[model samples]
Target: MSETVVSVRDVNIYQGSNLVLQDVNFNINRGEFVYLVGKTGTGKSSLLKTLYGELPLREGTANVAGFDLKGMNWKKVPFLRRNLGVVFQDFQLLTDRNVHQNLRFVLKATGWTDEKLIEEKINDVLDKVGLKSKGFKMPFEMSGGEQQRVDIARALLNSPKLILADEPTGNLDPETSDEIMQLLFQICKDYGTAIVMATHDFIVINRYPSRMLKTERNRVLDSAVPA
Candidate 1:
């Protein structure tokens, strides 16, 4: 049996009065890499938002990395996000800062204050993401693949147990997407970080098949079981 890290039961989400997700339920386990797929606007992003408390779970319950989303307050949102490493379709790296500086920015904002230790940690995570020599390069100076690697490195600075990525490879070409997926999968295997990535690329799914969840007909479907 897998260790459950995220559990969503009968969850419903609303955005300014429109019901986006209805009765969504799933259990993602530790060290797992799961894919979230559906047509655009099927509520994949909303479900991820609800799990991370970006949107409120008004009709049910979701517990992610030990925090209950249904009852959590704004003060706890940062705490919830701290346990998660979130990646986006766009590389949200700062153009002004070099790769190492960008990662150090996250560490400092998250309350890491040690000078020597923070530098060491930044180098460590950059090395882990296979971007050791590029730490001094700015985001625009690197290739798209390298920039995405920096995004992953920034997400790893806090040692999160779970990563929620929404359309993380939407902008990349196939080869670059494959490299990024490999890096994410390696993170799961090496650090036991459970990942829930929402994507629309079918070829990637066929290549690295895992447990999947899809949003369809306003319901979340568990792809491992017969529908």
Candidate 2:
């Protein structure tokens, strides 16, 4: 049986009073790698925001990582986020901290308190992202790919069931992009972590095709559906 990590149905996404997307319905299952592709300004960000609890799902029924999105408030957003991980295009690692400290910060913020467990968790994520030895290195001291890996490591700190990645390969070179893609696929396959990545890189898409959700003309199109 496939486990569903993200379920959106009859959802209306908005930015303030402006409606961005309507009647959006989709479900991402465990270990599935899905692509979110659409031109800019087509509510891609809004949909992603709604999933991660950054935007409120005001007029629909949706659930993410077992949390109901309808009527979700600010106080409940953090709890929703802990079950999810988000990856950004730009490596959003903290400038002031080393790789270890950055991951440690997220764990602490998310309510991890045991010092021994914290150290083990940090090591586990770093090892998963292939940054075990670079924990002492500052973000500035690493290459773009390495920094992005640290960003990924940070995302894995909570062992999230779903990861929402926004243009994760946008800033990398072709080779680096390939490496990131491979790593992402490996993680999904190995850990049953569902990934919904938003990207405009068609070349990457052609090289590694998967189910896609396209945003166009105020609606989301699912590739899995027959025309």
Candidate 3:
């Protein structure tokens, strides 16, 4: 049986005291790559925030990477996040650090103490993202796409079970966007890691279609089933 990485049911998502989405329901399984699409204020980001424990799940139940989201305190947020990866539209690489240092920071923050294992894991993820030889290069030394690869490599530091990517391809050119899309899909297939990517790029969506969860009219519509 396929293991579920994210399970949300009858979820009422809120930003502060205001409700953004009602009766949201979905299940993202291992190796599944699902798209979260919607207009700017259609609660796409809010939903992702809820899943990542940034925003509280006020009225529904959710399990992300085996961590219960309901009543999740700030103390437990880091633990939950450790099992999940989050990719942003901007590369968000530290300007002061090289690619290797960027990834090293994350490992140390996540409690990795062995130097040998850290080097091995960083090299492994860099290789996975096609940046095996660029680790010593600074963020500004590389192209936008290459920096983005480092960001992805950082996400892979812990071998997360799920990745929540917010507009990962948003800042790239068409070709670069395609490359990132391919890399993300490859990661999903190769590692059995589930991905829930939020994107507004219909062109990219059309180029590589998958199960879609759209937020519209204050609700989430699962296109994997009949409307």
Candidate 4:
């Protein structure tokens, strides 16, 4: 069995007087692909924020990447993010920087020095996302899919244990979305990197079946598997 990478116990989150989620209990095992689906305002983003330590847990308990979400330290936010690979619908890449420079920036900021070693690691991760030739291209020069691949490459620089994606394919065409989905799945299968993606794309969910978790009627529904 894969290791349980994320564990939540009756987690509740709120924004002002609004209770976004109630009693959200679930487990995400290593190498598992999970889909978080719901209406536009059903706490998807909030959950991702909590996982990455952007928001504090107001009630219950949560653990992600071995850090306590309820009592997470301020200084450890960077450390938590380093263990998590985060992707967004909008490809967040520096337009002025080449793919190599972008990846290098993350390495240098994350405390990776040693020019020779940094270059080697950058090359290795670029290759991992099937973008070895893209190292010299600018973000705008690359195709949308390729740009997202570069984003994935940046996320993988730290060899994160889990990938938390927020609407990862929300801006892509159907074909491009399929390609991105396949890429994410392949990475999880090959590297045992568990993934929890929040998206409204039910078409992709229908095309590629995964363990589904949805927020409905003030509760989290794990409906993909028979209980």
Candidate 5:
């Protein structure tokens, strides 16, 4: 049976007091790679925030990584996030820490206590992102691409079932963006992790086509199921 990693139905997304998206409906399955594309201020970020519990899901029946979005409290948001990985446009790595320390800090905050296990998991994710040898390097020591890799490694720390990637390739060059795209698709195929990536790079989207969800005129239009 195919598993639904994210299901949003009749969702009304808000930013502050404005209704950004209305009556949104979509279903993302395990191992699926879906692209979220739209112009700025079209509710792409708002929708992504809703999925990862950054924005409140009001007037909707939505479930993400098995967590119901309705009535989600601040205390419960972290638990919901534990099962979902979020990638930002700007790689939000701690500048004060090296790659390994950055990853370890996330693990520790997420309740990981065993030192040996943390080390092992760190290596595994680093290896997955092709940065196994750069764990000791500081964030400033790496290139934008390398730093982005570290960000991806951090996202994998929890072995999350779903990843909400917000413009993951927004800051990279063509070559580096291609590399990140390959890595992301590989993760989805290899680990059965569903990915919902928000991007405005049409070159990358056209280069690597997948199911697309476009945010236009206060609604989400799915290319897979044409309206």
Candidate 6:
């Protein structure tokens, strides 16, 4: 059976009072790798925000990682986030912390109380991202690719069902981007985690094609749909 990680139906996304995307509908299944592509100001960010519960979904029936987006509130947002991971273009690691402490901080904030379990989880993610030995290094001491790996490792700490990656390879060189892309695809396959990556890199898309969801003309276009 195919499991849905994100489902948006009859949605109208907005930024403040401005309608950003209209009639958006899509379903992303578990272990699927989907690319979200759009030009600047084409409502891609709005759609991502809605999926992650950062922006209120006032005009749609959508579910992300089994949480009803329409019913999301400030109190429920944290719980919803626990089931999802978000990766950014910029490796948003704290400058003062090493990789281990950075990962530990996220686990603690998300309510992991057992020290032994936390240590194990951190180790697990670092190993997955090919950074097992670099956990003691500070973010500034690492290369762009390594920092991005730590960011990915941090995202995996909660074992989320869906990962929302915003331009995850935007900051790296072509070679480094390839490495990150491979790691992302590996994670999706190995863990059965769904990924929705928003990117403007057409070169990356051509190199590693998959299902694509494009935001254009105030609407979302799915490549799965026939013209």
Instruction: Note the Cα lDDT for every prediction shown.
Output: 0.88, 0.92, 0.93, 0.89, 0.93, 0.95
1-227: candidate 4 lDDT, tens digit per residue? 76889999988988777888898899999999999998877788888888998887889998898888888878988988889989978889988889999999999988897999999999998998889887999898888888888888888999998999888888888998999899999999999999999989989999998998997777788975466
Cα lDDT of model 1 by residue, 149-200, tens digit: 8888888888888998888788889999999999999999999999999998
Ranking of predictions according to lDDT = 6, 3, 5, 2, 4, 1
TM-score ranking, best first:
6, 3, 2, 5, 1, 4
| Candidate 3 ranges beyond 4 A from true positions | none
Count clashing pairs, candidate 4.
0
Q: What TM-score fits each model? A: 0.96, 0.98, 0.99, 0.95, 0.98, 0.99
The ten-residue window of minimal lDDT in model 2 covers 148-157
Task: Note the residue pairs that clash in candidate 4.
Answer: none
Per-candidate alpha-carbon RMSD to the true structure: 1.1, 0.8, 0.6, 1.4, 0.8, 0.5
Best by lDDT: 6
Clashing pairs in 2: none
Question: For model 3, what is the alpha-carbon lDDT of residue 33?
Answer: 98
Expressed as tens digits, the lDDT of each residue in 1-227 for candidate 2 is 89998888898888999988999988889999999999999999999998998887899899899999997899999999998889999888889989899999999999999999999999999999888898999999999999989888888889999999999999999999999999999999999999999999999999999999999999999999976
The lDDT, on a scale of 0 to 1, for candidate 5 is: 0.93
How many residue pairs clash per model?
0, 0, 0, 0, 0, 0
Prediction 1 global C-alpha lDDT: 0.88
lDDT of 6 by residue, 1-227 (tens): 89999999999998999999999989999999999999999999999999889999999799999999999999999999999999999989999999999999999999999999999999999999999999899999999999999999988889999999999999999999999999999999999999999999999999999999999999999999996
- Model 3, backbone clash pairs (residues 3+ apart or across chains), number: 0
